[model samples]
Each structure stands twice: as structure tokens, then as C-alpha cells.
Target chain A: MTTLAMTGRPLLQVEGLTHRYGSRIGCRDVTFDLWPGEVLGIVGESGSGKTTLLKCLSAQMEPHAGHVVYDTREDGPQDVFALSEPRRRLLMRTDWGIVHQHPVEGLRMKVSAGANVGERLMAVGARHYGEIRGAALDWLGRVEIARDRIDDMPRTFSGGMLQRLQIARNLVSRPRLVFMDEPTGSLDVSVQARLLDLLRGLVADLGLSVIVVTHDLAVARLLAHRLMVMRAGAVVEEGLTDQVLDDPQHPYTQLLVASILHP
Target chain B: MTASPSLSLAGIGKQFTLHVQGGVVLPVLAGVALDVAPGECVALHGPSGSGKSSLLRLVYGNYRAQAGSIAIRHRGQTIDVAAASAQTILKLRRYTLGYVSQFLRVIPRVPAIDVVAEPARAVGMTAAEAERRAERLLSRLRIPERLWSLPPATFSGGEQQRINLARGFVVDYPVLLLDEPTAALDADNRRTVVSLIHEAKARGTALLGIFHDAEVRDQVADRLFAMRPPSMAA
Candidate 1:
């Protein structure tokens, strides 16, 4: 059953995404199709440009060439790279959220939890602090943090709780799509498992689509519907999560799988 | 069951007075005690108000205990964390202890590589030697070489955490105190990190951390400390 890749109209299509850094290889002619409601895992070792691809999709980094087309499930396809600043702001201001492997990247450490969540609302035009704080507390509770800690600095949190705060801060805005980069790269194994369970549970409950960048096959197995393996800045293999994992075709993918020495 | 140097607290306690509204004082942590040993990975499990993190902070020397003692036996010498001199504590932290907080606790604007290498460079390594070592450590942690030259703040959460780990291990501190390192990952990234922790422990770094996940507690923790409610703290 895992081998049956879901077939549907692509929600996000990348065509010839070629990026470079002064003669260095950085994802050459990368192409892929992300369907609606899909959890696509982009897996690769360090320097594989998995993160770069994520940044490009979110319009945080401009691609040297090629185009990213995000087809809003409710609206039509929009070329992300070609978007004007104002349009990009509108999109980011309304429809997108991003989570990083580290908790602080998505969080405003100095601000209260409410402000972190409310910053998104304010960016899209929420004016009142009361409303922002209210929403922030709600999001905090959603992520299972107490309402009282809403005013506490993020530094006071544990790595797991900080990550949860990052999630709350991002997901509070109700964006249709979210970007997850190395989502749990700093946690212990058991904490990783629980956080994974929380994230999968949240994703299912929110009915949100996510693009997760990671280097672990085991992670992709647990949370992703499909997996794309990248090698030297290119998609070396891709298919249903199980297919790519169970019977990897690319030599690099094979080695990557073999490297999974679980105890 | 092996006897590596242990981190222990006997009647370890802390308190602070805060003046609310009209010069009032509040005690944050009171009569807290815990222990960890060389080769021991201990997990502190408690809710937000349970003083779990306060105990970690006390161990890291960020919080000075209003009462009781914080000490660790290292290199055949036991140093009191509360009474250690600034220079002494700085030296101890650099060579013997690694503390990873939830936030980027180090000062900003330092290059990621420099952030990791500063401790090694502090004792005596040349800049070039430190640079080389830093690169190797960050790369092994899977931090992209491209981001190594940038400030840690410029990197993503995961990237920054890798830098923190690199910094912690660059000096090869035998004892590491980590606060909830994997709360943000989706699944795959989380497992990779956990795997790395296991690898580090196998390499002989004793770890004391606060974790929210029972799975994390079971996987890496040799012992678990479940804090009682505030009323039972003393």
C-alpha cells in the first residue's frame, strides 16, 4: 500500500531550478511536483541544497533561475520567484508559515509568546495588543504550553518546548502551507519521537500541507507520504515514501539507507 | 554502572525575592537537589513551573543559588560552581562543561565557526587550528559549510543548534547540560539529532538535560528526575 504513490494535480511544480554560488553546485535543474495535502520529504546530506530549496519555495531566497509555482488549493497557481515584493508580502503575510530545526529561528526570543504569534497577525494588519496576546495564548495552548508562560522569554524554555513555541508561532497564523527545515535536528532520540508524534498529530488535525527538509530516512518514513532524495544539488530519487526507502534506486540513496544504523 | 565522575546535588537549593507592585520578594527555586555522573545521561522531567530548568540553570552557573552548594568533581578536583571564581568557572566551562540552553545563549555577531572554535582558541590553539577543527565538527553535525562563515543568527534553528553542539564538543567537555534540544523537529530531523546524541555519549560525554518526551528519556537517559510540585520542592 505504501508503494502506491498518490496521483493528483500538482499543487506545487518546480521547473529547472538552477541555483549557484560563484562556481559551486547548488541544486542544478531541480524539478518536482507536490500534490495537495502531501507531506513531501526532501532528504539529503549536508550541502545537498535541501535547505536552499526550502528557502526558495518560501520565497525567502531568490533562485538564480527556474521557477516555483505554488497552486493554492483554493485559488490558482502562482509563480513564487516572479512575485513582486508587495505580492510576496501579501502571500507571506497571509498564506505561509515556516518552521526551522532550531526553535529560536522562528521565534522572537525577547518578545512574549503572544507577540510572537501576534507578529504574524500584525504583519497582516492586526492592530490591538490584546487580540494579539489572546491569539498567542490560544496558539500556545494548542501546542500544549501553559498560558502563563506566554510572557516568558523563549530562552527559559527547554529545547523541546522552544520548538513547540516555534510551531505555535508559525502555525497560529493559519497559513495553508508551511515549510519545515530540519524540524528536530537538535533533540534527543526519545524527545525526537514525541515531538514527531506531536507534529504528525498537529499536521493531521490542521489539515495543512507541509514541505519538510531532512537528512533522515526514518523521519521521512514516519511522517512523509513521499520522499525525494537529493545528491550534489539534484533530486536523485523520488517516489512514495516506502518505495524510495524500501527499495532505493540511486547509489547515493542506497548508501544513505545503509547509514541508518539504529540500535 | 560504571564510575565516571558524577554531577550530584545534596540539599541543592535556590531562592530569589522579587518585589511585585510594592517591593515584594518571590523565591524562584527552593531546596532543589539532583545528580549526574560521568557516562550518565540523566533527564529532568517536569512541567513548566516545576523548577526543572531552574535546576539546569543552577548547574550551568547562570543562576547563583541563594542557599546550598553546586559542585562537580573533575580531573581529581571538585570545584564549587557557586563559589568558583569567574576565571575558574570560565576555565571550567571551557574545558570541562558544555551548557546548551534553549536560546542562542552566546553573544551574537560571532561567525558560526568562530562561535564553535572560541573555546579551543581560548586555551591555546592557533586561529588556523581552531578554524580547521571547527569546520570538521560542524560538518560532522551536518551544518552546511556555506553557512559556517555567517553569524549563527543568520542560520535557521536547526543550523544554529548544530553550531551550538559543535561549540559544546569543540572543546571536548566531558559533561554537557542540554535544555530540550529537539522540541521543534517534525520527525526525521529529530531522529538524526537523537542519533548524534547517542553517538556523543558513546564517545564519553556525560549529559544532563531537561526533556518533555518520554521516548527521549528512555532512549538516551540513564536516569530520570521527575520534579515534585512547588510545595514539595524544599
Candidate 2:
């Protein structure tokens, strides 16, 4: 059976999505459907408006035009931008998650790692401190953090550990759709590899629908099933990850792939 | 042996337009047609750059063909790979079609067993059962027990290829595409791959493969489809 037939409807659909910074175009005329459990990568070099598109999609910034329709658990397909502020806030805290490029931006530096994760559960109306703490501990273990480090402040954690903590914090609420802004961008190569592996496994196991923005093609290839290549605030190409990377029908894409320094 | 074809490609055409090089169009395959019936193995015979791998990729929905249709019989319905949505193609890849490329590409740091078992898990096999099948295939393919928990990145070329093979065979897909599956294998491993191909064909899987090794091709392939570079043929 087809995935469309199985899932019934797309988890998220972006129709002619356009965003702008004053007069400068951020991203233009972008449209795609994200199926359940699909990982769609947005790849471009610096200043390609990948982050801007992500912000608009995540409801952090309202787009100049177009619609972001999300299939809510309770409601059917609803325009994300048209929702009330409190409803949008609830959606972000409940069914949606946004992971920033920097862990510090996504985490509460003052709180302990366990509390950072537990806070999400709390926002989702989770009661009982013991239960929240228990879930936090379980999530910490899943992210490869040591049990002893549950009470440690996120500021004290290593860069990789902090990213993992941020991921755990975002994922504890069981969000169906996650918007990640270069989740592994700030880490070293080996650390990035480890975190990418963790994200890949978690995405598969949880069947999360993710839109990851990255400049690194290797990261996109590893985590994304499909890719959209952005250039000058517009999509130059979009296709299956291997198709876009290997055959690269677009000249910009070919240049990007050819520019990678092969070890 | 005359059962209907599980995979069919008709009037297929693919060409690469090199925009950077002054918009030059490189013709790869033109007006090609192919079919693989149930319980059959079709080998793609060609020299390098003859678009054998490209044909397989087109069938797998990795590379979109410029023209024509790739009709696959999946779950009692015919789905055109050329026109299918990304989600449909993904579902087809998961439940209907399986492809093993020449190289092993996987997320770094995932254990080799998990990499091999992922397809089976995607197709609804329990983690335990999928891991069991993965272990069996790895053992039969002669992967060391110690290496099962380690990533295949550091393994020898042949070992990595064997791991790829184990992954392809992990799930019993109705249609399979293999790209130089045994190219880097040793005699023993090659023998294992040949036997695996035979077993898959016996189970009625329609296979389209590029077996550069003549011996392996002769052993597993029921027929050969010769391909020449369209531009070079003229």
C-alpha cells in the first residue's frame, strides 16, 4: 500500500510558502508535503535563507505569504499561521518542537538537565514530580547521558552532551513534528557524527516528522530521506537525497556537491 | 517461469543537463525497455558509463527518469515509480522494492546489525525478530561476531559489501535491485552472494542486478540485457 493511503493525510503541508525580511526575500514560493515519519532536509550555504524558512515553518516567525497547514491530533488540517496566539503556543508546547542551532538557545541554562526535560512534560500538563523526574531520567538515558548527571546544570555539560540534553528536552513531550536548525552544526566532527546517529535512531523509532536545515551535505544525506536545495532565497532543486546528491540536476547543486573536500 | 513481470519499464529515457557546462545535455539511456518476471533474475550487461546503474536507480526511484514509466506490481496494484509521490516511493521502497548499491551508506556509529536490520524493522518486523534475522545473515555471510556491534565504516571493503548484501536480503521484498553486489567480494563471500541470489529467485523475487563478475552472473542470472551508451552506440 502507498504511504499516502496508509497515513491518510500529510502531517504537514507548505503551500507556496514565502517569507521576507523587509524587502529582502527570505525564501520564496516553497511548497512540499511532509509525510508521517518523513525527514526532509533543507540545505544551502550561508545566507541562503534556510534558517528563515525554518523560522516561518516552526511558527516562530510569520510568513509574508503562503500557508503552513498542520494536521493536529485533535483537529484536522488547520492553518498554523491563522491559529490564535495561545493555541499556537499550545501547539508548540504539545505537538510541535523546535531545536535551535545552539543548545543554550533551546535549553534553560539555570535549571538541571532533568528539570529541563521535566519542564516540557510539565508544560504538557504532566503532574507529580516523581513521575516527571522518572520520565526525565528515562529520556536522559535514551540520549546517552549518564544517570548521575541528571541533576547537573546544562551549562556544565559538554557541547555534545548539551545538544543531547536539548534533544531530550524537545522530545520528552512526544512532538509529532520537529523543526531543527542545524542540530549538529556547533559540534566537532566526531561529536556531530555521534549526535547524528542518535538523531537518526530516535527519528526512526519514534516515527517523527522532521524538517532539518543544514549546510552540511553529509548530514543531510545521513538523516534526510528527501532534500530541498536553496539558493538566493529560493529552491533550486528538490528530490530524493541520493538523487539530488548523486545525479545533481541543478548546477548550483552540482557545484555544492563538487565543492566538498574529499578526505 | 512465464508468470507476469513484477517490474516493468517501457520507453524509458534519462538525460543529464549540465547547466554549469553551458547547458549541455548528456544522454544516458534512450528508449530503453526492460522487464523482470516473478522468480527471474535479469543481469544488466554493459561497460562502465553505459547507464546500467542509472537504470537500477531509476527503478528504485532514486533518479527520476526524464520520460516513460516504471510500473511495479506492489501489493496487487501497479504503481508507476516515475510519477509516484515521495511518500508512495518511500512506502514502495520499504514494503515492495529493495535496493543494494555498490557501497555501504549508513548513519555513523549505528552498530552493523542495526544497519542491516533497519529495513526489516521498517517493513513491520519486530526489533527482536529483525535482529535475529540480521544476526543469521551476518553469520552466514561470515561477519565476525565481534564486528557485529561495531560500525561497518572501518571494515575492509569486502566486509562492508557483505554487510550491504546482508541488509538487502534481510527483508524479503518482491522486487530487488542490486548494483555490483559482489564486486568487492572474495570467492567465499561471492559464493554466499550467489547462493543468496538463488534463494531470492527461488522465493519468487524479481531481481535486476549488475553482476560485473561473469562467474556470479552466469550462476544467478536467467537472462542478460545488454546496454551500450546511447551516444556511443551511434
Candidate 3:
């Protein structure tokens, strides 16, 4: 479904979400509902609180104010901020997947590739040696890696492969809501394009609800079904992807769109 | 006798009962039928919530169907996926089905090479043979040699996706289901995936896929199936 269409039920709901780093506000009065299978792009320039807001939503940081309600697999709503640390972590491992901008931050460098991917499955309580190993291999191939390197460590992989591997690890169990912070920000242009395409397909195929924080309008335009433009810790504009990108209503949005440095 | 279609779905219907919503039943798909012949590729295209992914899951036996028969032919055996027992489905999946989705799922602490080689290992291939195949595919996909010994947990999105592709293709299953197989691949890597898919097709693999990229769809798909979202269709 088109994200802005409001057909599917909202998987995540944010209300008055405000956070601050000391005196500076990270995000102010942020409110939105992310529908199932929708990709919501939070776009802004660097230092626009996009990353800050993502951290708050992903439960990486505690917000000074606000409520982030997530629909659990059991069809019940849980306030993310209210959950205990262990419960929150369990949610992160089971129902939620997070992709970090820096690949290293998301992956465990000491573990082997197979273990990296397999850990997600194990986190969800998957046992049976043969089944686990086989699923791990299948996921490696799905992410485009060859199977022979299942025992290798993450330190040996290139930057691009590292990011891919992190994705494999995060997504192996098929999380319902995936929070991505500049998932392809460090990659080269060609690599970014490939990652974006892969992400779009995965989002669609899995019916995943994604909230991706990005400064690049192009990244938002290509992968996001809905756009939310943030500036100085506040949402300046929000709408459907085409409406927000092709025709801007706010002066700041107009400036952001106009300033896009096309390749 | 003529061989049955590689995959056949007849009057497939799926409805989800929303117990939380006063037991409301939403019909996601209904009266859907399709077939894929050996060496042919079929693509599913539709707006979001149109049940394209659901159909794939149904064929893969990940989702149970309310109505319909999903028959996949392998080794002259026509197994009805929708009604097959769990053990039957498991056996069929071990050797006959291959799926490539956008994300890669590997076991933690395993090497990238072993992750890719496990598919062949599942179907009774020798460990050595599977590892050799994994090496060749990894090199062909352009994964660095050094990474072969490392875990993919720290690899980038593109690299992880390549690992996933290698695993899916290693088994050379008779019926393959691909969901955006080349979405994360670069131009060169995309070309490599294309060739791999072509080779799979040449080997008489029956393929069903969903490609958001029109270029890739055109290059590989023999037909397209359009689906209407459940809301509209209902």
C-alpha cells in the first residue's frame, strides 16, 4: 500500500517525541504513525537532529519527553520507553532490526560471518544445528556472498561487504520494523544505488515497516514512500513521497529540494 | 506423459482473521491461479499490499492458505504445497526450492564462505564440493578473497547481499523463488546475477520473482502478474 494512503494499521506511533542533549533540543514535538510495510524517510541536512530522533525512536537513547508505541507481534501495543532494558533488547533482536550508518557499529567484528548471521536466528531461539547452518548459508547467498567463508571474521571484509554482512545479521530473522540510520551514507555512489535497490525490494518483499534517517534527498526520494523533513529539531513538512519531493510547500523544503546536488 | 508445470496454483485464497479487530477477516487474495513451466520466469508486480509477497510465501509454504492448491513438480512428483505435511514440505524445500530475498540471514560466528556453501551441504553435497562451489561463486560475485575467511557480520549491505545470492544459487533447485535478487548489486554484480539467473533458467529451473527494477525484470521475466490490493479487490 502507498504509505500515505493510511490503509494498513500503523505499526509504530510517535507522539510529542522530544529529546535534548543538555540545552540543545534533539527533536521537538515529533509526531507520526508508520504504517505496516511503509518506509518513512526522515530527511534533513547534517546536524538536523535526524540521527538524534532516530536514536530515540530506536531505543538507543532515552528521550527527555515523548512516547514511542510499537505494535508487538502479539497484536498489542507497548510503549518502547517504558519497557525494561532486557525486554527492549529482546524486542530489538526479535521484532526490530536496526542498520547503522557505520557497518562496524552494527556487526560483531570478532565473530565469523556465519555466526554473525546465525546469531540473529539463535536470538529468536532457533536451534537444530543443521537447520541453523543451512538457513545461514541461504541468507548469505540472498545477500550475494559466497558460502565458503562462513567461518571468517568480520575484520577481513571490505567496507561494502561489511555493511552487507551487518544487514544480513540484522535481517536474518525478518524483523517487522527496521530502523536504518544512514544505511548507505558512507558508501560510494554506485554502492549506494545498489543498496537502495536492495532495500526497496526487501521492504516490499517482507512487508517491513522502515524508518530511515538520511540527509540525502535522493536516498529519501528513491526508497521512501512518505517523507518527513526535519529542520532544527522540528518537522517542517510531511507528505507522500512524490508530493513532498516534486512539489515542496514549505520554503525550507523548497530550499532543500532545490539544493540537491545531482550527480 | 507430459511433465506438469513446475509450479501450479489454482484458486488460491488467503484471509487473515484479525482477532484484535472484533474477529474481522480480511481477504488478502482470492481465486488466484498461476503456473510456471521449467526454464520459464514469472514476475509478480503490484502496488503495496496487493498480495504479491503473500503469493510468494504461499508457494514457499511460509503462509497457510485458506483455499487453493499449490502444486510444485520435482523429480516427477507433484507435491501440493498448500496441503503438504510439514515433513513433506521440509523435504521438498531441502532439494527442490530456492529463494533469494533482499536480506541475508547467516549464523553468527561462521565464516562468509561457509554461509554461502551451506545450501549445497543441505542437499547431501560433499562439504568439500560445496566449499569449492562457494569459492567460485564468491570470486565470480567479486567478494574479496580475504573476506572469505571472515564473518559477514561486519560487511557492508552490498557484500552481505552477494553472500545471500550465492547461497540461493548454490543448490540449483528445480523451482526458484527470487524476491528482488539483484536489487543490491552494482552494475557489474547485477550483470553477474543476471548471468546466474540465466544459467539457472538454462538448467530448467522454474522461477518466480518480484523485481521492482524494470530493467532487470525485462531482462529476465517471461511474464508478469498484476495483483490488486486486498482492500480494493474485496
Candidate 4:
């Protein structure tokens, strides 16, 4: 398949990224560049090593080998693995947001919705209480939550609401790049549509770059500009979302597309 | 005489009065007429500010129309959406009108599976039966079994969306409104939605939708209604 045109400057670059669990290769020799304001979708089945690549890219786990570089707001381009722990933490707090598959995993279930969102702002050094609360309220609304529920704990919120609240928390600080692990995976169809619209709007409005790992091709089709198809710990195909999804060159990709329920 | 379409909008117009600048009137949609036949999927195509979403809201009686009649055939009765009372609208919405919006509004602390089964439970199905259906749909949509029992408070966006889809589709209404139904879905899930749409159509539901993604639009839409911004309208 023809490759997508790499536009602007690369926001995150992964070169020969390989991770393993003893003898099992999680992902091997995975290389890609995510550009500013672009969304890259990594598509593969469970146990296909997509998650491993995402973890490596997000700096949540150390890869066995390979280099992951991120263009920092302060430093021009720095290898993320090379950054000091405090600096990486700072970068994660400021320039990056990670949305896990489970909202509870990413969110503080014990805290009120307002606090969950406000805490991100606090981490970024926003000390004024009123401003923090105001920003939290604003983000809650943006994610389609009732402002009145801001004081409620996440444990009280429903799965969909919790997910929205989680998104609100991650996005309150307007980070430049977001790593989403199946961001829209578990919700109902109608709710999924709304959240997708909200997320698309936010990505556009803020010019945020995103790396979303999903097993669903439709999710990748809607939100991703570029596509990376992985299997057996290696990239099988990588191209523009349309090029790869529509006219897949790889046999595995064809099988994946063919496997979709045509009902 | 031929029966009226399942949904008919004639010369529909809507405008928002700006609060500032001495009530500057902004005409968002005007003189729009469309018909959706039973079992048909009609796509509302437009630019961002073109009022496609507003038109759907108007049909659903969420917005008041200024100029025309928005009518739907429900239980063998023709209800004028423009002139319907709140109670009438509510009654129609309960069983006749189904809307799959972009976002899901869920109750707190509810398990994701239970949330999907709510609509089924509401319509007199036993909790076990409702949950059984919910489980099948959730599994089809690729929601993991482990996450089923847990409250969605922590589920990712896609997982939450699958639950929402299961909920919206559980009722099997005769007329359905979809606003970007597959927007957040991965390819596999999009195909699932396509199949669901086909199933709804086979059951003779009239569908009106907004599809920004051309590929999905091509996959499901039987026809297209081009909506233009007021400034771009001839």
C-alpha cells in the first residue's frame, strides 16, 4: 500500500521499537511518526502486540530495545526513554495525556468529578481554587456532563459518564499529545457517537495529536488519519486510513476486513 | 391515495435569536423539505454550521420550528412534531421514536452491561432476559467479559460507546434517528453498526442520520439530503 505523506514535523517518532515478555515478542521493529494535529490508529487483534507498542510509545513501559523520541514544548526533540524521571513526569503532566481502556484506572474514583478534573490543572501549577474549579466545570460541560454532577464522586457516575469524566480530566490541561487505548471501546452506540463527536471536536479545536490503539477498524476509520496494522509483534501494513482500510495490500489486513460482520 | 412518508418535513425553517447585538437574527435552516420512507436510510450531508443536527432535533421535537410542519407516522396516527404537546411528544418518544445520539448520558455506579440492558428492561423484559440480550450485543461489539460487571465509570471511550449502542438499539423502534452512529467505532465495530442498521431496516424502521465519514455514509445511506449553510444557500 502507498504510505501516508508525513506532514509538518513529527511530534512523536518511534524507531525499531521492540518489547518482549521472555521468549514471546510483544512487538518488534515497530517504527512510525505521529505528526502534530494528526491521529494515528494502531489496529490489531488482542495479543497482536498493539498494546505493547502503545505502552512503549507512551513511556509507561521500557522496551527491550529501540528509541522513542518526542518533540517537547521546551526541548526541541528528546528521546523520551532518556529523559529523567522527574522530567518525564513533568512531560506527562504537561505535554501528554493517557486515556486508559478503563476509566477507573485513569481516574480517581474516590474524588469528586470536579476534583478529578481540577487536580490535573493543579498538577500543572494552577493554584487558584476558583480558576481550577471554573476550568473543571467548563471541561465537564465540554464532555457533556451536567455541571451539577461535578461535585459527585466518579464511583457514583455511570460507565459512560465516568468515561466522559475521565476524558474531561485528561483534557482539562489541553495536552499536545494524547495516547488513547480504545478510547471508545465499551459504551453504547448512541453514547459512543456523541463522545466521538466531542472528541473529534476537541482534537480539532485544540490541534491535539493522538495515538489511538483499537481493535475496531471503524473507530480507526472515523478518528484516525493514518493507520498501522500489526500482527505477531510486527507491522503488517501501514498507510493512510482509507488506503489501508479500503484496499488493503496485506493478506492479514484483507482477512481482518473480511472478518467484519456484514449483517 | 398513497400514504404519507414515515417522516415528512415540509418547508421547515428555524432561526436562533442572538442574545447580544440587539437580537441579531440568524437563520440556520429554512425552506427545507424531506421525506424518509420506511426501511430507508437517509443521510443528512452538510458542512459544520449547516443545521443538519438542528433539523434532526426539530423532528425529534427538541427544537421548535418557525415555519413548517414536521410530521411522523406513529401507531397509525400522524403527529405534527411542530405542534405536538410535551405529553404527546413524550408518549411518542417512549415507543415510536428512537434516537441514537453522539453522546451517552448514563446513571452513575451502574454496571456497563446493566446500562445497555436498561431499555429492554424498561419495556417489560425480565432483568435476566434484558441482560442476556445486552450480553450478546456487548460481546458482538467486542466489550470484554471482564468489564461487563464493573461500572463503566472506568471504561474507555470506545467501550462506553459500545454500551451506548447496545442501549439505543435494544428497543427496536419503528423510526430511528442517528447522529454519526459509527463515529467512534473501530472498523470491526463500524461493521457491527452497519449490520445493526441493516437489521433495523429489515424491520422497516425509517432512519435519518448524519455521516461525516464518507466511507460509512456510502456503506449504509440509501439516499442523501444536501444541507447548505444559510450563506451558501441559493
Candidate 3 iRMSD in angstroms:
19.5
Model 4, span B1-234: residue lDDT tens: 154478989999888654333456788998999999888999999889999888887888766688899788877788887776443565567677888777775444567887788777656689899899999899889999999987786777777778788887888888899888788889999999999999999988999999888888998899999999998895
Model 2: per-residue Cα lDDT over A1-263, one tens digit each = 23235557889999999988889999999898988889999999999999999999999999999999999999899999899999999999989989999999999999999999999999999999999999999999999999999999988899999999999999999999999999999999999998998999899889899999999999999999999999999999998888789889889998899889878
Estimate, for each residue in B1-234, the C-alpha lDDT of model 3 and write its tens digit.
165589999999987654434556778899999989999999998997888877887788766787999888856677887776543565577799887877875444568998898778768789999999999999999999999988797899999999998888888899999988887778999889889989999999999998888888899999998889877776
For residues B197-232, could you state the per-residue lDDT of candidate 2 as single tens digits? 989999999999999899999999999999998977
DockQ of each: 0.01, 0.52, 0.02, 0.02
TM-score of each: 0.51, 0.96, 0.53, 0.54
Evaluated at residue B217, the lDDT of candidate 4 is 92
**Candidates ranked, most accurate by TM-score first:** 2, 4, 3, 1
Superposed model 3: Cα runs more than 4 Å off: A1-8, B1-234
Report the CAPRI category for model 4: incorrect
Scanning candidate 1 chain A in windows of ten residues, the lowest lDDT window is A1-10
Ranking of all predicted structures according to DockQ, beginning with the best and ending with the worst: 2, 3, 4, 1
Preferred candidate (DockQ higher): 1 or 4: 4
Task: Score each candidate by Cα lDDT.
Answer: 0.75, 0.92, 0.84, 0.84
Candidate 4 ranges beyond 4 A from true positions:
A1-8, B1-234
- lDDT tens digits by residue: candidate 3, A116-210: 99989998999987888998898888777789878889898877778888888888998999999999898987677667766766775687889
Pairwise TM-score winner, candidates 1 and 2: 2
The model with the greater DockQ, 2 or 4, is: 2
